[model samples]
Target chain A: MSARDDILGSVRRSLRRDRLSDEAQAALQRRIRAHERNIVPQRGSGSGAEIAARFIDEAKSVAVTVQPVASDAEVPDAIVRYLAQHNLPARVAMAPSAALEQIPWASRPTLEVRRGAARPDDQVSVTPAFAGIAETGTLMLTSGAETPTTLNLLPYDHVVVMRTSQIVGSYEDAWDLLRQSRSRADGLIDMPRTVNFITGPSRTGDIEQKILMGAHGPRRLHIVLIEDA
Target chain B: MESTSHRFKENAREGMANPSLQRAMENMRRGFPDKRLAAIGRLPEFDALRDRARDIKNHVLEHLDFYLEAWEAKVTAAGGHVHWCRDAEEARRTVLAICRRLEARTVTKGKSMIAEEIALNPFLEANGIEPIETDLGEYIIQIRNEPPSHIIAPAIHLTQDDIEKSFRASHRQLDPGRPLSEPHQLLDEARSLLRDKFIAADVGITGANFLIAETGSSVIVTNEGNGDLTQTLTKAHIVVTSLEKVVPTLEDAQTILRVLARSATGQDYSVYTTVSTGPRRPEDLDGPGEYHVVLLDNGRSRMLGTEFHDMLRCIRCGACMNHCPVYATVGGHAYGWVYPGPMGAVLTPSLIGVDEAGHLPNASTFCGKCESVCPMRIPLPRMMRHWREREFERHLSPAASRYGLGLWAFLAKRPRLYRLVNGLMARVLGLLGREHGGFRHLPLAGGWTGGRDMPAPEGEGFHQAWARKRRERTRAA
Candidate 1:
């Protein structure tokens, strides 16, 4: 017998069942299809503005820098200012998302921005988030031609622009949004190649349990929150 | 991978004596439990979530075969492959096949204990392939040529000075005077040294925190994001994980994730929780072109429906060890295997065999802290007791202990003789210890009184004291 059959057979013997009954199979299928939620925390529940405020506060608590701006047009200016303040280069590897491309980057002629996936040579990368979860101060990013997962990982400085309206109260809300998009009437979520939930800058407590940031990922995570846009 | 579990007593003595190991163990004992308490303190529903997490795992284990089959179909549908490996040798061979097929000369690996279980690094090096461990902790141990003493904090056994010495010796190309004194500097050095490896490795291997059947997703819970870099930059991504990690859906994954990070590191959530569905999609700009899941069943299926079946619910959180008194003193390496602590004590016997690892189950103080902190609510002490019983049944216990238990059992059955002997012994000990009230040493209990004194029995036997009290009460009435 194949290793698969041998192992499964052992499991069946141990479980004292030759095979799954029809009722058991049907119940499991229903649970998978329903994808029911269990005991989601109440910490993320509030009004939109309140949730956004909580997002900023919670994000800051986890060592994330959040800058709430008035419009999408100010995002370029905000990035420019943040880079200048940190004494970084005025360059970015911007994602090829339409939402990011529509930003008025032409207004800032001095800034050098390239649109593509992250490069080893790229010092900074700006990627648009699919959603912001306020409960844990997390940014949910999807992989695609536009988002291209590397932007969130390879850059030294990562600047994410998330609209206040896109910020939800919990991970459940974000997952629900993902499930609703492109479902084939079977309640199955057509997940992207990858969905990354990033809470803060990359860190490690490996060395004698001392937390050191910038370990093989971004050193600084700056969120340019577009509020009242 | 060799069993030093039989030499646990000696290993524990050395572990406690080493200044560096003691210092590291002290830090864990002081920090982790308090941090877990504070993290859970903020969430009122933390205990309820643990219950839900237990139910979810119990459901999965009951229908493990069905879930694994369903998950394999979904993985194949998503343009990936699943290899069923019965043991460590098969798992190693399967990984080698994938690497040879890809012509992989350099393999970048994330932190996976399954790799440790198979002893993959040496096997790869012998086969003329270089395997670079990318997690900061794993990298530290890799340089030092040591197995991880702790699962999560692989380098916790080493002091900062130790790391500085290893870095200087390993990275000879870097300037010797680069002020590599601080943890941040050490981290920066590793980050730069490994960035090129991420780009250069032909294949990347990682362990899954959870494998979802609904969307064919393998979730990685990390704080440093090196696993993401290791997988995303490689041409092919291979997941070296076990069968018990499979969950039924994304929602079930979320339920476990809610409790996992909090229990492990006192974090509300790990920094990066990435769920990979398959290889890079057609429209995706960058990701691995190939994806493979090696589902290892190394002795886990046989453990099902036994006294030790609940051991499969382990999420590798490291909390049980964090709160285990035996672990706090001996550290992880003394358990002498891939796993350690209360979980290891129970699991090692079942996986390796009680005869080889019988001492591990006997190393516990039965403080019940491990069970109290366990997110999956595994009865760790109860399972350890089961191992002891199995050892006794097999005549694997020491002759002295067997004879002692035999004597006690014989005496316990005769109540009249038991009380008479007990009264005589208590009177003798009471007279002997009247001056000091304790004994510094004893005849057969040298192991017990080797380090400390044993308190003497007080006054009369229990039956005599009860009778005297009853007569005095009657006279007063």
Candidate 2:
């Protein structure tokens, strides 16, 4: 027998059963399909403004800098000001998503914006997040043609552009959004190749249990939160 | 990987005497538990979530074969391959075959206890594949040629000076005078040094925190982004995880994640939780072109339906060890395997046999702190007792312990004789130690009295005192 059959057979013998009956399999399938939420924390549940506020506060507490902009047009200026404030280079490896294309990068002529996956030498990256999780101040980014997963890593600095409308109260809410957004006509969930829930800049407490930021990933995580979506 | 576990007493003695290891453990005891308390304090639903997490795992374990088959179908549909390995050797062979097929020279790895269990690095190096550990803690220990001292914090046994010395010796090309004073400077050096390896590696190997059977995705939770970089930059990505990691759906994964980081590092959430479903799509700009999942059993399947079955609920949070008195004192290395602490005490014997790893179960104090703090609520103390019972039943326990237990059983069954002998001994010891109120040395209890004086018994034994107290209470009533 193959290793798969041998292992599965052993599991069945240990579990005291052969292949599960049809009724049992159906019940298991139903549980997975239901995708029920268990004990969603009360902390992140609130109105739109309240949820967005909590998201910002939670993000800030974890050492991520959050800037609330009034509109999409303000994003370019926000990025430019943030770069200048931090003394970072004006060059950015921006994700070429349709939502990000709405921003007026031309207004910031001094900035060198390269729209593609981040390169090995890229110092900074700017990507539009799919959603902001209010519970833990996490940004949800999915891999796709326009948004390469590399931009989320490899770079020393990561600047995420998100809107208040994209903020969700919990991780369960984010999963619901993902399922609804990616549901196919055949009733299957076309899950993304990769989904990253990044809460803060990369850090490690490996050496003497001392926390240090920028360990093999972005050191600085700056969020440009658009207030008026 | 090698079992020095039979010499646990000596290993623990060495561990306790090592000043640097003691200092490092002191820092960990001060840091991890308090942070976990604060993190859990912020969420009112934390305990409720733990219960939900435990139930979800229980449900999956009962129907594990069903879930694995379902998960295999999802992975196949997503264009990913799943390999089933019965033990460590097959697991290693499967991984090496994939790497060889990809023509991989150098592979970058994220921190994985499973990788340590299989001893993948040595196997790969022997096969001419250079495996570079990407997690900072793993990198530090890997260069020093040591196994992870702690599951989450691999270099928790080392001091900052040790790391600086290791870096100086390994990265000899760099300037010798460069300041490595602060932790950030070390981080910067490692970041720059590893950046090239991440970009140039042919394959990336990582362990899964949870495998979502619903989406056929492997989830990796880490503080550093090395896991992301490892999977994204390499041409092929391989997940080497065990059977128990699989959960039924994304929601199930979320329920467990809610408690994972808070228990592990006291964070509301880890810095990065990345879920990878399969290989990169045709439209994708950058990701691993090939993806494979290796499911390892390694005696775990046999653990099912046994007394040790509850050990499968472990999330590798390190909370049990963080709060374990034995772990806090002797640190992780003394348990002498890939796992350590309360969890390791119960698990080591099951994986490595009761004879070889029997001493680990005897190392616990059974204070019940581990079970109280366990997010999965595994009855860790009870499980350790079970291992002890198994050892005794198999005659794997030492001759002295067996003789001691035989005497105990004999005395315990004869209550009248036991109380009579106890009273006589108490009276004699009480009179003999009237001056000091304790014995400086004893005949048979040299091990107990070696470190400190053993307190003498009171004038009256426990039975006499209890009988007098009861009579007084009856008279008062």
* Top-TM-score structure, candidate number: 2
- The DockQ scores of all candidates, in the order shown, are 0.86, 0.91
Predicted candidate 1 versus true structure: per-residue lDDT over B1-477, tens digit per residue? 677888888888899899988888888888778888888988888899899999998999999988998899888888998999999999999999999999999999999989888888988888888999999989988988888887777777788888999999999999998998988999999998899999999999999999998888899989999999989999999999999999987878887888898899999899999999889999999999999999899899989899999899999999999988888888898998878888889988887888889999998889898899898999999999999999999999888778889988898899999889889988888889989999999888787787579888886899988999999999999
Model 2 spans with C-alpha error above 4 angstroms: B451-453, B475-477
The window of 10 residues in a row where model 1 chain A has the poorest summed lDDT is: A181-190
Q: Give the chain B TM-score for each candidate.
A: 0.96, 0.98
Residue B430 C-alpha lDDT in model 1: 86
Candidate 2 CAPRI level: high
CA lDDT, candidate 2, residue B200: 89
- Over B1-477, each residue of candidate 2 has an lDDT whose tens digit, in order, gives 787788888889999999999999999999999999999999989999999999999998999999999998999899999999999999999999999999999999998889999999999999999999999999999999988889999999999988999999999999999999788888899999999999889999999999888889999999999999999999999999999999998888998999999999999999999999999999999899999999999999999999999999999999999999999899899989999999988888889888888989888878999999999999999999998898889888768768887997898899999999889989999888888999999887777687679788887799999999999999999
Clashing pairs in 1: none
